[model samples]
Target: MPVIGVLPYFKDIHIEEEDSVALAQRVVFPRPGAFNIAVLALPHLSNFTDFSWIERMGSLHVYYTDDPAQLAGAQLIILPGSKNTIDDLLYIRGRSLDRVVVDAARAGIPVVGICGGYQMMGLTVADPYGVEGAVRTVDGLGILPVHTVLEKEKTTVVRRFRFGATDGPACAGYEIHMGRTEAVGGERPLNYVGEGFDGYRAGAGCWGTYMHGILDNRAVVEELLAAAGAPGLEIKWFDYKKFREEQYDRLADHIRSHVNMEGIYRNLRLQKR
Candidate 1:
């Protein structure tokens, strides 16, 4: 039997219940915005909160949905990291969403994959040691001409790297996974870590990488948006580090400075934006 996480409830909206809580925790509707982007919320989807900053972006509305119809209108599609790549890949095939994604890719919608999602975008994933559960080999989505071999050894590291070329934007992120992938087709390299290349990119607006938080950087986000056909998107640069500092300061103010009761009252009295 598959395990499921508890469905979250927000405000006064009641979520539709389903047989399994995992699949039931469905669609994350679009926020007030212009661009409509969709992300595949794979079963055992991990590090999804990495997109929190993206969700807060004013011009970008992210939809975390499994329905193929909802995906039809997306400018860009994202395949997020999964805890169990093979099983989640099977889950996607079971739901018949693999065809939807492939069709979308064929129709020119930009698609990107991260970590295990990166693995799934390849040609084949061979798990001879059962590192991610059952010992098996399976064909991937074949979006990228790459092959992955799952192993017992896992790679976990944090580093700052550039997008392969000297003129490419600088990016920082971490890697955590149990497979090593190699490019088999004529796909362009995605990024340069320290001494070697570490991702695959194609002219078809498809990208795959093992790095997490690659989208957190402003440059990468802008580049991806431009490729997705929203060339003139005006995305406000959000300093995530600065925002964290401000939040920490606010928390300290509440704890050390007598709760700032009058300040809260003054804010409440101000007109809404």
Candidate 2:
């Protein structure tokens, strides 16, 4: 088993105005032997940019992986939200990656499924609208004994949700999914939206939620790290809105440094010529 260490919470990091720029730059760079996290890549993946927050925290090194072998050293695995859940699941199974995730979860590695990833963790998922052009029930990984049905009314709302009895921290995020999940065997629901199932936690290590923008909540990441057995880290309390604005500014700076916007624009102009 990989030895887990708890890092200090966010509150411990005292960030001065002058240090913010340096901290953001340093966070974007991966550290050697840092805790590795594998994010399962889907063809229709979105919101991958959110991972910048994790990287800035310095506790996790995130990588994209579709290969099952990559899961071996990952302390935590993230199944990000996808536009095509059925296709992604089938692609993973076809590559024998489904077994890899199940094996990892069974071995007590932390696994998080968000939105479509959440649906894949259930017993069965039914998409009736043919949004992804598939209307069939598929077997889930069964990490959580839940069932999800895609409804016509798509949920795209930002709201705050109260976490119940969880060890990490209180979390709030935006929901952007069409399917609603229900626990079949009377298990406690992971998330609650006025008595409806919004998320589920299988054990101390594995958790899934329907919220797409949960990463916007630094408290959520801190709690997740704590649950994953990271070293005890201090928690920083900040206005969530202000924190998000800071993150966005930092992200813009990161992109300016790493991405060649000028070169891309020149190339586009040349192509137009």
Candidate 3:
């Protein structure tokens, strides 16, 4: 029997009926043997909250370890977006975690990098403008033969994309990055924006993309999990508007229980600006 953790209900929603209460409790809680994911901890990291979708699915553990050996047990390794790509890469190298990441990829583990993490998967990352104040090019993990150049043009927008042959739902997300990537000769692209390279998936186990919030796309999550060799997982669709409402309610309730809403609202407002 799998063990699930049932979280308390949000203040706005009430579970008065017996069956509804049980289902809500089950959803709030999760069973054991759930997929474990390791998210690399880099300074100035954001969007940790977006991973709530994964928590809703099953037992998800977050690891902040820079130790390579600690990453070996996770079924999925996520290199999350960071505010400073060059600094994060330097930090990883300082901690000697670069070899760990490469070793994980070589061992056939499913490693996904988003934004700064995505930039780190290439052959070189150049920052010439000193926008990040690093102004130096560094060698990437070399999982993909891609090079990213930090440019004045920053791409920030929400859009929908279709990729992969599976009949799953379309992927919708926001792209927020200061770097532009180009595929080297002989490398395949993962996504395109009107025929421009947006991302790349290397072999069966490694994937990198500039898209943030892609995890919100249930189909994309399922596809990545399947590539990781997960069994018996399927994508299901619901009214997107309704789903967003429910999710906001759930998050509001959860945060309200533990912290003051003033700080949360303030931070969100600043992010929008």
Candidate 4:
């Protein structure tokens, strides 16, 4: 079941009733002066919830699509995590989205990858242990100068790191993947986490990292947009926890008015006082 199934209204005039509710619960709908952004709609995409933080300002018009043509004009491009890296990477190749991503990078459009996405952006992914399946190896998008090898031990841990510049700000995210990657060339890492760093920054607008909730960090989001050459798109971060609580109260009000609560209570053998 999805969150929109029960909600009644939506801020977007275009979205149908059901989907609007789902998005409404997750993000602030119809932000003013929204900048267009695209997220690769992979078949196995996962952990996209953190994107809500990026869209919190309502300044980004975010949409998920698998079409390569859609990548042309996006202000920012994100390659989200996947449960199966090789399979999804093959899917990108089969659909020719790999070329689209590479082209977008050449055009200076910001591209950020998380977890499985980071692996696919590398030079090659070697699955010696068959951690992802029968596929032994696959060539990556060849965008970032890195190589990844799938391992048997899955890494799932909370991480704290510095993004964009090494001396910038300390940001926290998580790592949940089944591979190890190493930089093979002059590509500089995107962040410094603990004693080590994460991801590789190919350019001002090009990078990839294993951090799952990288966008949850305010500095990272601002940097991503600014690197995309839109410095005027100011971010206004708000309390998500507070917003969620308010939404819950609104939902409760709607349910109380619309539902036959007394009837439901009686049916459940509870006192309806």
Candidate 5:
């Protein structure tokens, strides 16, 4: 079993100032965890909210870390979406996490990547059209037998897909990426989207998918956590839309019953005194 430790929420690193103004804010940590997951917070990470719901789950402790050493205790490692695949792949190599992630997967720790992270898990990524940066080919993590060729036209769509070769439920997610991945060495796919395959699963603990909200489905998440050795953790079947709707209704009721618009107006009038 991997060593699970409760660490600080996020590192206190200096974020460069942009035209947008900001101030220091509190970073909320997850509850007491049964499973520890480390997410690679790349420089241009996007669509990170895909994991926000899972972070709120009681059974899992998800933290974003850039240090390769932090991969030691993580039972599952997630390579999150990035705006720039080539640059982020280089960043992972620079941090020496490429080998670390590969070794972790080989050791039976489940590894998952979303979007650009999926691109990095392939055998090779060729950006011939310079969709991201320079027109170059970079070696991927090689966990999966797929190769990606970035195209000028981006694919953005929302669809429901059945899990490929697994007993998992049908998952619905959106795809927003600029590359098309093709399996070259007959690797099993992760899911089937429309008439085509969408992802690849390598070995017992490696998975790469273009789907963004793959983990949002209850059945999929449960199966993954169980494979990562965090079985029997309570699966809180949450309806996120219903939760938001109830919150909105509760806020409206509170305002209609307890808020004092007249008293506020009178108070504002008397504030001159």
Candidate 6:
């Protein structure tokens, strides 16, 4: 309890930067949406920000919930990345959201999963090495024909990949997970990382992948929207990578604006004299 008193500031403050063209994150927003997306709120959800880019694209409303009734009207249902796959999987089952996901898949609703969520889209996930806390296996949602095994060494790397063919325009993403998922059969790969596969697609609107940030690419987002049967909804394109870099530049500018570097240097020089 004493540690809290000794630590740094833990409250709200303004964050600004260069010329203010770079926007600050505001808690309140005027949400005018046309698409309803339900992201499963797993107990240990890690990369929920993976879908933040979509919120920038106008007309999409993404919210997280665990209730089955709340998922009923969603055009797209996403299972975001989790830190503890086994624990979160058990959490999903305990809430009976597993049945909801399975039923949604059968009903042909667009269902997507990333990283730990991707592993849960398969038939089985075995933690033989106890990398996920227990040396056991659990049944998955059965949406895709894949099997996952959690090994000791975790996979953490950035990847450039393309959907369908190797010659397509490459999109950027990063993988950070302990499981290695393999195709059991029937499911077509969603993308190619180098000459190898990275994700699986069983049918229309059903796919799973270990890659994060894949949605940042306009082409990939378009395909995903189309798969979700939103062809009428047109996507406004922007380079998310470029946008991210601008954010960093603005952050630097913000720091410079607040800190008097020249004054500090003069004070240090006088002290030495």
lDDT (CA) per prediction = 0.78, 0.69, 0.70, 0.78, 0.76, 0.76
The number of clashing residue pairs in model 1 is 0
Candidate 2 residue-wise lDDT, 101-147, digit = tens? 88888887888898888888888888877767655767888887889
Write the residue-wise lDDT of candidate 1 on 61-140 in tens digits. 87787777776768888989888899988888888888988898888888889988889999998999887786499889
Residues forming the 10-long window of minimal summed lDDT in candidate 6: 19-28
Residue 267 lDDT, candidate 3, scale 0-100 = 71
Candidate 4 TM-score over all chains jointly: 0.77
Candidates sorted by TM-score, best first: 6, 1, 5, 4, 3, 2
Off by over 4 Å in 5: 1-33, 166-168, 244-273
* Model 5: lowest-lDDT 10 consecutive positions: 19-28
How would you encode candidate 5's per-residue C-alpha lDDT over 129-165 as one tens digit per residue?
8778864899999888889999999899997888755
Q: Which ten residues in a row have the lowest lDDT in candidate 3?
A: 15-24
Model 2 error, position 141 (Å): 1.4
Q: Judged by TM-score, which candidate is best?
A: 6
**TM, every model:** 0.80, 0.72, 0.72, 0.77, 0.77, 0.82
- The local distance difference test score of model 4 is 0.78
Candidate 4 Cα outliers beyond 4 Å, as residue runs: 1-34, 241-273
Better of 1 and 6 by TM-score: 6
lDDT of 5: 0.76
Candidate 4: tens digits of C-alpha lDDT, residues 1-273: 323224467442221122123532332222245576777777787786657666556667787777787666577888888889999999999999988888888877888788888888889999999878999999999888899999899899999888867786898889988999998856588889876888888876788899977887777877787888888875678865566567767667777766667766675785544
Q: What ranges in model 3 sit over 4 Å off?
A: 1-34, 59-62, 165-169, 192-197, 233-243, 247-273
Off by over 4 Å in 1: 1-27, 30-33, 185-187, 252-273
Q: Superposing every Cα of model 6 onto the true structure, what RMSD results?
A: 6.8
